[model samples]
Target: MAIKPRSIFEEVSETQKPVAAPGGIDAKGRGARGAIRVWLMMLFALVVVMITVGGLTRLTDSGLSITEWAPLSGSVPPLNAAQWEAEFEAYKQIPEYTEQNAGMSMAEFKVIYWWEWGHRQLGRFIGLVWGLGFAYFLVRRQIPTGWTGRLVFIGALGGLQGAIGWWMVHSGLQEGMLDVASYRLATHLGLAFVILGFIAWYTFSLGRREADLMQARRAGDAGLVTLSGVLVGFALVQILLGALVAGIDAGRNFPNWPLMTTGTGASFFPPDPFSLTPIWRNFFEDAGLVQFVHRMSGYLLMAFAVFVWWRARRSPNTQTRFGFNAMLALMVVQMVIGILTVLYSAPVQIAIVHQLTAVVLWIAILRARFLARYPIAQSIRG
Candidate 1:
């Protein structure tokens, strides 16, 4: 056989070309990420409303108005005068009514009843949204890989929160109790924040592609991540402490700032801070102690947040720095709102704003932490 002359473009060796990643489950799953994020965002808004309604319920002393946790039947409010009276009678049997709201009129009872009913109804709606959304995504095979369990976990928490809400109400129904136990209230509120935190984190993660996140993580600032994580822990503890403050009406007791005092004396501690028998009970029951702890925790949280923000100033990423800056600014705003809430004796409007601000700050800190761990890339001009 005659050999043909070698062409100028002849290959010296076989070189494999890069192949595009195949279309598969993960690719299809990613395609639906935007939709899933929107669903999650809806859940986020509903949960925020739920938390606000829950706060208003507690503030208005309406949590015990239903006096029962009839999850299925409770979705519907009384439609007639007779049914309303029956519902009022049930509430009358609870300790909250006999001890604090004796002789409350039917109209007043209706107001409180509606407050609680609306709270529960919103909860039911949230469950429906999550259930339907999750089911639709599941049936369509749109859920991202490794996300089914996470979504399920949120639903599971929501269900448990419902039970805990009833448990809290049950505490007030017990003989001689004026309100739900502060610790249990703390548990309930704490779990809400945890659920909110997870939803927020998942939302942040879904904002970027999985591969992009992995690559960005390689360039992340580990120290800033750790610092921000500590800040988140501090913020969470402050939140639980705030729940304690709300649980026992502690916020109204200390109307002064820079120093917490009671009606009794010039002492920094409220009267009978440790008067509770078990001593441990003081931490949860004593208004002075609870608010004091909340105040101190707030200070510590702010200090730590400042440090985290300061450290984040050195981050190479512009978005990451801006996130930390916003977090620090919100922390300041929240601090002011909190002081105003206390100074105003926790009025319904200001107190609710304070609580909502905490929610905002919690999410901001989480966003900062996320950025620290998986910073967004910037263009040369940025």
Candidate 2:
């Protein structure tokens, strides 16, 4: 006797019984996504902490502490009086200590020493977490083939960031400079943003896959994705300009927003007129111009975000509409934070928030982009 074919609903319900509930993803699948999402958020948070610690290290003039670059050995902090003295002696040989921190005792060295130590330790922890997490996913065969290559690429980028950090430090250790090269400072910050952007993109990708599997596509999807990508690009550029401003300590001079200095008119330009010559000098050495440019970039980014939101409102997709609105709100908050940071001369609390808000906005934009691209996929999964 031949068996009759089951109805589509009956077949689906049978499958659901084994792996997931009706209208829900499986427990294992949900758990995997949850773990990955948490790890990505943690990485983002760690970057913010690293940036804050770096700012403090700069403010305290502690970046050059423990001059030696013993990547393996330096992981262990000084444990005794003799070890502390040895570390202090290493620091004393650097120009920063001799020229700027001379006459400082071992006790004083300890203060700065700890800040640098904490920064390095955070870097190591990030490496370990990413490495172990990726291995776990790989062994379980849970990570999709499409994402495996990207994960490896990001892991390598993390390693490169470590090397770049030491390269930045090595500049100050060389003979002539009392502080790290401003250009190196800019590069270090630029790489941090790169890592951040990648993380935001990856997290958005995962979220998009889930959403696609849940919701069906509507209209204006392609335009929305394009707009999202544009917004993220603009935000990244603004972040780079902000790094330039920080590198030259530009915040110290232009404490006012909407104007370069406290004065009025064209005199507000850097005193030298052709002031920032050689192009390169303008980016790292010309404090006034750097800050001015950064302020202008912020305004540009805000305008772009608002425009994206306005266009998204016209789209038929509800999720895209919500994401665009989120992007718009974050943009406004970020602009306010940037102005406050400038007006406050980049105070530690405000400055760190400014940096963090940028990351948040990037993530929002990424979400919008992913939603737009995968609407159909989501509907099928649902």
- In every candidate, how many clashes are there? 0, 9
| lDDT values for all models | 0.90, 0.75
lDDT of 2 at 5: 89
TM-score of every model? 0.93, 0.81
**lDDT (10s digit) by residue, model 1, range 1-382:** 9998999898788789988785443365574789999999999999999999999999998888887788898787899989998999998887788889999999899898889899999999999999999999999988888899999999999999999988988888899999898888889999999999999999999988888888899989999998898888888889989999999999998688877664664566567678889889889888888888898888888888888888999988999999999999999999999999989999999999999999999999999999999999888788
lDDT of 2 by residue, 1-382 (tens): 9999888777453343465466344333443665676777788778778877877777667888967677788899989999988888888888887888889987788898999999899888888888998999889877754567777887888899888888988998989788888778777877887887788767765654443444544433777778788877777777777777766567767777666654454344554424656776766677777777777778777877788788878866566677778878888888888888878888777877777777677777777776666643225333
Q: Poorest 10 consecutive residues of model 2 by lDDT?
A: 22-31
Candidate 1 has which clashing residue pairs, if any?
A: none
Q: How far is 212's C-alpha from truth in model 1 (Å)?
A: 0.8
Compared with the true structure, the alpha-carbon lDDT of candidate 1 equals 0.90
How far off is model 2, as Cα RMSD?
6.5
| Model 2's TM-score against the true structure | 0.81
